[model samples]
Target: MACMQLLLLLCLLVSLCNCYRMFGRFSRIPPEPQSDSAVQDQWFEQKLDHFRGADTRVWKQRFYVNDSFTHSDGPVFLMIGGEGSANPAWMTHGTWITFAEKMGALCLLLEHRFYGKSHPTKDLSVDNLRYLSSRQALADLAHFQTVMTEKLGLGKRKWIVFGGSYPGCLAAWYRLKFPHLAHAAVASSAPVQAKLNFSEYLDVVQSSLARNDSDCPNKFKVASATLIQLLNFVENYEKITSDFRLCQPLEINTKMDRAFFLDTIAEYIMDVVQYNNDNREFEGVKTTNITIQVVCGIMANESWGSPYDRYVEVIRTILKATGEKCIEASYKKYVEEMRSSCWEGPAASGGRQWMYQTCTEFGYFQSSDSSSQPFSGFPLSYHVQQCTDIYGNEFNLAMITGAIQQTVENYGGLNIESSRIVFPNGLIDPWHALGINTSLGTDIVAIPMQDAAHCADMYPARPEEPFVLPAVRKLVYELLTKWLQL
Candidate 1:
């Protein structure tokens, strides 16, 4: 039951990333919440559109630079921010900062073009969101590199790009696109492959649960089976409503409401699993490290309650932790909230921006259609429906498929052609479903961190963390040193 707070932190923590969209803010949103008293804010004048030369539109992109440990002609380590505010703490902290000190490199963390304080558009309107894409973000990195080199009077210093999660994709892609600008890349938990039917997301989640406690998956499976039964029977509808303690009575007959109710439960569990233990905290909420293990133990304890009841307890407890009176089970309200154009609620925290990105480009929708997975309420169709509703009718399944095809073709997807890039994926991280988890070539290497969660390797090695993380960090440093020829 203590794990409830951690799950609450998962959805409500704006500094991180999850809101029924993807990743726990899917761990892309709020960066690790650190005190910014020592951090200085810096901004870069960037072109909104890099593709069109005629468009002179520009935006002030936020960034932080740490040259405390620098040398003339030393390498520059640029940590790319993903789908959230760029924290200056990365420039000072993180495993990369250690490498920066060892190699006498200058550290920089650049905010994504439209995220955080970097507003490339006046509003997150559909028309303005067109400027936001991975391609454009990559171009921003390219231009930023040039700006830094000239602005700081650094002559031809080797630039190593670093990113985790989505930006991890950006780092690897940046290296591939502008090899001359970026000498090497460290893409941790980088999902390079653009997947539509990302049912494997839950596969990893279930596996992670089983890893903590083997019977935990069985509990969830049994619970899901019971839930399926409950949803199927009209007589059990009241029991379902009473058991979950919904604020609004669930429209049991409506397909959308049923999905909303079941998916809401599945989502809380999925969020906890996806970002199980990356050691990130936001606002006043705590990290999900110890809670994940605790939750697994609770899940398997039959003495506590039945499997379905325990499952409901997890959701109910989490909702209670979030300070909600009851479950907001209105699918219509949820859809309306997502469809809202203003930069409040989901829009303010980059969820809306990222949703638009997913709708237009990367459809990394995590559904529970896979038979091997424990949960089964949220399917690929649910995501497709949300996308169509939030964006427009043009954002249909066929269009999304074509867009993903174009993205994969453009970036090479799983078969990305690149060199001097290290893709470090967590063994338990569900997002690694679309990441390159194997060695591609002599230069493009994949390091799988066992018992690790998303971007675990990116953080600085600590004694209490898993042994693989420290080893992975050491390897990343050695790779950077070798690649930079330091």
Candidate 2:
């Protein structure tokens, strides 16, 4: 009887321990340290600083969690915004932060380094910028996942990574890099390719132009010819002199230089390609005629001013702080390197490190790199391609091309097992989604909005508003949810 009683007690103890372990793994996060279980109205926003390096290279982060949030049943969704955008902005946006909070999930935002308040360096050179690459950004996500899990002490909690555009690329890359860390990832309008091809972009633009007027085939043909002429003019001028002269054309009233024209064209191309055409009445819509006029105006000038003056100013400020000359001779040298045929350093045996150096060197001066070779076959005549603006300074077309190409090649692949990629285009937008062609197979779905221009999400009546395509959202949500199941 004594032996039997001892055996029973041991069995009971084992079962109790197992139950405790299981409970610990699957339990909800406990209440805040300072709050009682009854406190329903309290909210918490915690600021955190972490060092990825030893020499005080710290990254600033913030977390917003509402104590009053009653729904703890879903996964924790983390949102990362695109390049040049900060975390706070997205946190307040309708699609991101608002969505997470309403869905009853823990919402987290990560601001990339060297952008916004997450400056990780006193010297933000191309070399140091390596940490800001897609790889490093994904690593940052993985690290945060570990930290969140440990801090919350919830073993069964699921994690979802969500982003669009550039951040969407990060989201997809994160899922691939740290498959075990995140349960699922949602990438919308993400360009997975590291490089930019003007040819692919031209095709999209031509298609959009044709959609505007099927009978206006000649207009697109003319546009294509003009674009090529401009590209050749710029390339030739850059090959000859460090400085050129600009002459005002009869068409445009704006006083501009070569840099201005090139930058403007690049920006215009990017905009038209991603235009949201479904709702033409949106306040942000610009007519195709205006876009064409703007392009022509820039190219007509001998040397226009620099495009993206603000970006140049930022670079100047950084350079000034380091007691370096605002315009270094090396800056021009790097620009020349971008235009050279041997730009990527003999492509056959090159690795990502070479690409990193090329990116960083170019990033310093707001100049272009030699990464655009892949899309060199792109016909520039489709858009107004100009060499020198009104001010006589030449724009680095080769470098810009290279960078786009590099971006496409590096991050362009998709995971067939997990999710499907989609490129939604607008019919009137010159820079249509068709510009990028990925090697990730035909799993990508392209949906062209008839009248939209750049950023279809902001269309007057988005599909998400009235839930016009709840099925699409359902598909995305289900895929992410399944991926996140821990």
Candidate 3:
């Protein structure tokens, strides 16, 4: 009876699996049609849907063409999103999308693979995830170009790719990889080099604290000290423990916990930076409460309690825009791995393994860019060497730097001049955008946005109007137009 019951359960599970596979195969949204007659019609706005690749994975795509279309006017504008996002929510709802609609040109938003409704594979490992690389992403845009020209029968219509941040990097790469495909490309806040160095970002935080002088120094100091202490505890676990027993949860004062404190400082800084750079005392007293809420929310949630949590959150926001859910399960699994392996062995016996395993919980630390030699041009390796030399192997600075550098380099390189790529950065960015001082004969366009944090664009309330707004937009737009023409 027991054997029969098990066989029935197995059969049911197989049936359910088969049903899911079949459902996924037919779930894709179909591309809209473009009327050939409308190609010459300037007042015809239409959306298109079609399958481009041979693979059965027929991912859905949307094309918003203006009311008027003429092959004589040349290439249509294609918007690419940054980082793990499919499309910018702001663009879809804000002035950008409206501008595209008014321009009377085809505005194509291509969702990146593995994001939104475009899951390209069943497995999401580091190996299979290689498809998520910049090269493959560029290929997606190229495929769209072919579709627009050949399948859609839109004769001689050029494409102009535009994006900011990650998409900005993509725009530059698209121009480089497929020069003939696009007539023009515009990238904003483009990050072209790969590597992560937090020292400069740390310095930014310190400077901000000094400038504010708003009791935030205490919080910053506490957080920094806690991080160092945590590193020390992990490094000396074997020395302190006899048989590698799990230690009791370290009781931390909620008000003083480093993570909470850091979040508070970051929130205040971002609030100030995002709004018009008003150093005026924040009117709301809830800033501290909000910071505590953010910190506690991340820590209490099993999925968000890791060092790379910030990056993961950002990635999630981007992916969510495209209707993708890739990280939730992975995050849970990571937490389980850490919980199960804590203090399982001596520092020398299993410390490295434990650290690597737990570190993987943070998605931002994973990068494919590395060199066998110590001093290669790779910024990730350089930062890793610096960290390991100072703090030792207990904390894998290599992993952190490797992840940061790869993402930046893969998505951020902008070749403005024949001999140089300028990387303009605000002083207060935590991403350490200033850490990369030089790369591949590229000129660094490092602009220090006074009292700015993260991306300079985040500071909308800069005192200087002409220097901030028009300058940024014109520089990015002109660079893309010129690069595409070249």
Global lDDT scores for all candidate models: 0.78, 0.39, 0.38
Ranking of all predicted structures according to lDDT, beginning with the best and ending with the worst? 1, 2, 3
Q: Residue by residue across 118-213, what tens digits does model 1's lDDT show?
A: 888766777888888999999999999998899899898899999998999999999999998999999989988898888888888888988868
The TM-scores, one per candidate, come to 0.90, 0.52, 0.49
lDDT for position 317 in model 1: 66
Residue 105's C-alpha lDDT in candidate 1?
A: 89
As for lDDT, the candidate ahead, 1 or 2, is 1
Give the poorly placed runs of model 1, Cα more than 4 Å off: 1-25, 31-35, 232-248, 282-285, 290-292, 316-329
Candidate 2 deviant stretches above 4 angstroms: 1-57, 61-70, 96-102, 152-155, 196-198, 215-217, 220-266, 277-471, 481-486
lDDT of 3 at 270: 35
Cα lDDT tens digits for candidate 3, 52-108: 344444444433344233334544777774333232333233223443444445555
**Where does candidate 3 have its weakest 10-residue lDDT segment?**
21-30
Q: After the best TM-score superposition of candidate 3, give how far the Cα of residue 15 lies from its true spot, in angstroms.
A: 32
Worst window of 10 by summed lDDT in candidate 2: 21-30
Backbone clashes under 3 angstroms, per model: 8, 74, 29
